[model samples]
Target chain A: MKLGDPRKAYRIAQGAKVRLNEDDAADMSLCPEGGKNSTQGLFDSLRDRIQTLQKVLYAENKRRVLVIIQAMDTGGKDGCVKHVFSRVDPQGVNVKAFKKPTEDELAHDFLWRVHPHVPGNGEIVIFNRSHYEDIIAVRVKKLLPESVWKKRYQHVLDFERMLAEEGTTIVKLFLHISKDEQKRRLEKRLENPAKHWKFHVDDLADRKRWHDFTGAYEDLIERTSTDYAPWFVIPADRKWYRNLCVAKLFADTLEDLELNFPERDFDPSSIRIDD
Target chain B: MKLGDPRKAYRIAQGAKVRLNEDDAADMSLCPEGGKNSTQGLFDSLRDRIQTLQKVLYAENKRRVLVIIQAMDTGGKDGCVKHVFSRVDPQGVNVKAFKKPTEDELAHDFLWRVHPHVPGNGEIVIFNRSHYEDIIAVRVKKLLPESVWKKRYQHVLDFERMLAEEGTTIVKLFLHISKDEQKRRLEKRLENPAKHWKFHVDDLADRKRWHDFTGAYEDLIERTSTDYAPWFVIPADRKWYRNLCVAKLFADTLEDLELNFPERDFDPSSIRIDD
Candidate 1:
């Protein structure tokens, strides 16, 4: 087996897991193992930026955040949600992961199911898997008509526009991972008994349609990346790099909003009381 | 001044703030403060309970939580949201404060302004001030006629019942502060420069009808407390005690739900491969 070249189309003739320990995985350049911590500075800067933005955001009560993550299987969505938002004030943030619709949910329009979950003013809402799934997974699984899936593009754009108009700032990310990397992750789940619970046989069916999902994503990004909600295509082949990219983007988005506390009229004499 | 007896009705004169830092303030005969601290422990346990519930609720695709906080002015609604839920995983909670409605919001049904912000399943949604104001503040301010405000009592019950039917566990709290204590807080706000921003002339206007507000609250508790969502009247003369009561109720509610992670099958060889 040979290490795939980043310059060209990397191909794996045999489907096998790539064993990456923390030490070995430190080589993220897609070259020979040159041991260096490349992600530390990116994460540190992100943490600081988030804190400052948070103070402003909580006080301002003017803006809202809606983070939409679209990814292939095992693209580190959970890990990103945990580590990136670890220090944020829980009171002002929310995470919503859209899964297969329940009976009551299926009775409504697709957007109806998700609308209630969007953050209000002075909030940050994360959609772990979002409306894109209707276009990506449901389309791949043929769960909906080609016409229904195709029409959702316009519906999604309109929905996002409404949110943006109403003070919700949207940041969408597509986590791009190579087929080989995904296979390796799927295998690791089988090896660790503790993690074996996370592996689902149904997930492989989704894995088989990888290219189709990517094509759907590429189209979704191209079409839905509007002035209000732009999509960031992150290279998620390296988990550390992926987390770093997301953290920076998340931090940058909040900072760009210029959140701050409203000005208060002060009366200094009010604090002193002669008993 | 002689301490008033806890056994009878004590006159709380107009504009006079009660000082309860003495023996009278320590009257916890019916339900002692020690028991309340244990309830505080129960509330602290909610953080862990919510974490476990998340895995199941996210997988099950149920996203809904509605937390209602109702109290007298300066009853620690903001503080409860900040302190009780401080340790919640930031990714799963949303907080909304409902102040006086804007012209647009007033044009719609009372619940209409609130429906959009309900928590998606696996997400905890909090209302710092809720739809109950349709009756309480509106009634006290003479903003609505008796016919309208009285009708709202039944409307609120139906509204909350609908939420519970949709799988939201409603936890309602009324921070019960004595009138004398309210005056002291108002004076403190007036005397402190930093605190001056919190006090407004309108607050004094609300205090003028304090008895009327109390009567409205008594009626509300009697009519609204049901099996689906029980109301807890927290003795809130002490801020720390108020937080403790709310925290205990919150923790006990989630723990009662008995949340647990779903078991998954493990296969070791399926996940491991070498380069």
Candidate 2:
């Protein structure tokens, strides 16, 4: 099964206006004729390829990869990562899930905590939810005035631009799931005894303001997506397809680096082992 | 196969004298009678158990675990972590490797950079090298005066004591290997083309000053090991045995927590989802 180019299919073009409501949450247009069943083999291969590429990246030790994933509740952000990068070495890949800021974190500049977590040389760092929360959640919940949250779009762009210029490759993904699909997922969580710990009452409050959240995402993606750091709107309503697309997107991004293991400086043939 | 109690065998007694040269790097006293070959199944089970307990810890969202690993070059710090915690969820476990202090890091207090990376609630953090370096490396290399490095021991104790009082569990491990074993590992790295990237000429300088490093370690461990945050010295010449001991130590620590999935405050049966 041939996977379509995720860069072309999903990436939000720079300066393009985005409409979340108009986008298909269950789009499988990029999937091959065999659809989800046949794509499992491709997905597995992509994960293996990603693992191999990550090793080369780690060995190269000159560049970094930053993956930012944003999603509404039950949009499969966690599931997508679990399926896609499951094969990568945990030592090289770090997942940072940004929760509500503590008093100490809130006292600092918005990017202060985030700057410390950026990928060092030869590392892949994934931001599960990121500084965008300061813009999106704050805007929708009125935690900050429009004038305050409005400046963050430029601040984020500047921050990402600096990261990119400093040899960091950036990929931002928005797990796009429909409101109806979220309701189905929420209901499933409520029905399962084991999953109740994951179901929070506050999630219901976010669900009630779906349009506001979507609008916030649309604005953030439109304003933030750039040539340096592109935003990909992943159709996440279908679990299998979402995983496949994410795997392919990540593999494609890493391959573009043309990574290679570092050449040995000393002659290995001349070295002797006394053991 | 009965694995001996690691806590009883390896943990340094508070206020006790320590001698690095007296410890056996290849000691298998903790290993079961059946030895390395028999411990594979046990190792696999411990990894699984750690994974399960970590989930409960994440769900409980009350306590934190901090694992500190210290070792000489090629003493199997990375290898031990890879084998022991391979099954842990990457989302919950964070490994921070401290390399040479950067200009910015040197400008701040020793613990300032480390303060931000401590485990958050429901998280497990592993420090590949830690604030101990500020003492061990500084004293051994003569980077700081005796008076300056000596005071840091008290600072670290105060820092860790506060973390313990605030519901963070601390476990520190030092991987002990002999000079002959270090020579073998360094030679192996030079002999293998694939491992040449892991080798450095500076490692030889450290090896030449092995006595200095070990002496610093002895003094630091003797002074710093306390009831709140104790240190364990693992025999590490045998890779399999080192992994087994570390795995058992971690699993035993988590079991002491008696972790359970948190109960939902909202009644699951009463909660309804409109689909």
Candidate 3:
């Protein structure tokens, strides 16, 4: 199969019912031949394509792209963003990691803090964690009531629709990892002193409530997967496959923009630079 | 008359045709009971009220206020922002000056740069020069064709409407200074070595196109002013009156929100700290 051909298998269809447990988190059916070792070359090529496309997007200076990565703790959001976008120009791409809301942020509507960070023209913005948290984390943690969280599904849809109409192409990715894989990763973090800071005790608390989170995620994906902003579920148990899929998804999405260098508005041959 | 009562006199009615030359740049009909020397106390009081209201705004943290100031070159945008908001807490009030567009900024839609600097919840953001520049400056300089800049009127209206519906209180001020006043200000800048840095030869180029800019401003204000985002033409020749008017405008705007410190989410009375 071609590198980008399997993307549809991972994308949750608009209006389709989603069951997180039904999807195989470790599935590598789309992996290229010689799986792990040979994947590096493919990943590098995709990264190079992303870099070239991003430069053209910058040169064209018109369209915007927003990439949102959502994953459970240890599901590799940071790792995925780092590996996939490492070769892209830092100036053209902005990565915003949404942490716990500040006192000021909690006071406004959830979308208030988010609106300012959307991409400008000729830019790509990556949300490490995003507005989806207002739905998923709020529901799972009972941060707000059912009514409040339930209403946000529509709010998110309306907001994303508006953004799409305003010339932003949005892609959301949910990294899927099995519960056993999460446990193994947690163990690996604990085993190494170098990774100790990465192992948060609160992550264990989140793991305990895994089923609640999964239910919330499933509901959100089903509700918010629209034509403008679709959700992709990447099987992330294998780090290499996850990276490859994400890189390919970005490359394919940017290529679809059909971006090219903007035509020079002036006749370059008639101009002379005086020293 | 009360400090804020005459604000309506300066506000351009929605859908009203504007003639910049007809408005008195030195008019002080809305100025306080006293002239410039005796106006210090009232201005101080207004500043104090602004500071107080800003604190409550910070504490409440639910609404946003955006102040957009537009003017010709040497029209005192910086001075007005500095004097009017001097007493307010810097943390709660953000002032963003939109200068010339970088190559990256020129690549996208006109509103792209402006959207990112808008006020957050409980924040009061001042745009030293704003999106109006896209209409006024672009037209005066013939940077883009009439077909391009003319469409921006509707774009701005729609964009501001969205912001207003999303809970931002919008106040746009056109610091209305006479052409003569601008010439005087420019001369004053050139006379003082300390102020020479503020004067630029390019400003003379803009001054030469004064009639073009005035005409453009009239058309934009006539077309784009809405009930949600009204434009107030401040008589800006008298620096003291201008500052007083702006201070009163802000204080009155924040007061209308009826902001109060949020009630404690957790009861302090129920818990005691262990020493």
Candidate 4:
């Protein structure tokens, strides 16, 4: 399957598959034809192209693009944004990383805090662990009742549909890594002094419920993927391949829009300098 | 007087000053030597130096810095922040621009919305048109009754003293521009096509009541300029000079604290990689 169209290949076909990454990690490879070294160079070139396209995108100022990245712990979401989107002009792009909600955020509906940070026309925004967490985390941990959590799937669909109809292109990616890979990353974090701040004891408790999390992920993917805004499950054990695939998808989606510089209606030749 | 101590240079002595810039602009100059070209270079170097101090401040994690800049329309408050603080690490600095209150914010006390954004330790926060607006704008425009606005002066003094005692360094600047200079700026906005969006018809009405604004500004600066957070009147007719002056004040204040790099407990030789 073409790597650009990950939906057909990675979309959860079974509503009742009831597992996250149940297939072997070896089976989900989506790297284009190249050695690891060559693909790394290609990723750099794609990032440069994305930066150039972003200037035109800002000038055109017609549509907004929102990229939602959801991943398990130690799943390289920060690494993907830093490596891929850092080259773009900061004025044109905004990155909102949703941590724990605050008192005001809890006072309103789940979408209250997320709504204020949505991208405007001619803007590119990335949500690191976005509204999906409102559903996935609470569901798996049993933080909310089954009746409350189950109804959120339709709310998610309607929100995306409204945004899509109002000229937003939403690309949601679920970073899929093997359970063994997460264990290795967690151990590495504990061993490395520099990464110790990132390690939490509660994370070990969350790790214990790996199966429940997998079931929640499979259910969300089956229910929420739509034509207006589809979900793609990207193999994320290898950082280089994950960044390369996200950047490729971003570039392709923006290029399809055919953005152009805004029209300037003045005669520059007639203006004199040094007045 | 030393340029580093703008308090002596511009602080109002009595409950009133004859004018915002009563002396010659040449006398009010804070830029050191080499004319305008070199002052611009000095601003850049100070910005770089401020960036260095911010790193230590973040590591120290003991004190917070709050910068409050209040000015009339087209009074160079935005320009000062862009030129002075933009180079600081985005993680350490936040700029909050408060406009007309939202319905929810209005439902609460005036200080409710403003109190939440105060910086924590190891952070710098800038308020562009802050709570001081509660007194100046409302009093001049008669948005609130005389009895209600009169009590705000003491309230501001107490609020600022509490913050100062709790370990926040407050720097307040009133960007003082002449009414004539403001007229020229407003006219320039009309003549320049790119700046038309910033020009508003209501601004002309504000210009009509420049005297009332001046009276309100004089009163607030007198009532609220305690030793804890004294206000400086910056001569902002020249953008370059204004930026240089503000950056200088910031550098001198932070330097007086004598921040130190945090001690490293783990020896470099003890921690080995690639196990």
Q: Evaluate residue B249 in candidate 1 and report its C-alpha lDDT on the 0 to 100 scale.
A: 55
Candidate 3: where are CA atoms >4 Å away?
A1-4, B1-275
For each candidate, what is the lDDT?
0.68, 0.89, 0.82, 0.76
Q: Rank the candidates by DockQ, best first.
A: 2, 1, 4, 3
User: What local lDDT score does residue B167 receive in model 2, on the 0 to 100 scale?
Assistant: 96
Tell me the native contact fraction for each prediction: 0.33, 0.40, 0.00, 0.00
Point out the worst 10-residue segment of candidate 4 chain B by lDDT: B266-275
In terms of lDDT, which candidate is strongest? 2
* Least well predicted 10-residue stretch by lDDT in candidate 3 chain A: A266-275
Measured on C-alpha atoms, candidate 4 has an lDDT of 0.76
- The parts of candidate 2 lying over 4 Å away from their true place are A21-23, A29-44, A102-109, A263-275, B21-23, B33-37
For model 2, the DockQ equals 0.38
In model 4, state the lDDT of residue A213.
81
Higher-scoring candidate on lDDT, 2 or 3: 2
TM-score result, candidate 1: 0.70
Considering summed lDDT, which 10 consecutive residues are worst modelled in model 2 chain A?
A266-275
lDDT of 1 at A80: 79
The CA lDDT at A235 in model 2 is: 90
lDDT string for model 2 (B1-275, tens) is 78998889999999999998635888999874888889999898988888889888988888999999999999998888777875677787888888899999999999988988899889999999999999999999999899999999999999999999999999999999988898889888887666778987778788888889988899999999999999999999999999989998999999999987778889777766654
- In angstroms, the error of model 3 at B32 is 72
**lDDT (tens digit, per residue) of candidate 4 on B46-141:** 888897888778767788999999988888877787678756654466677777888898788778889988888887888989999888888988
lDDT of 3 at A151: 93
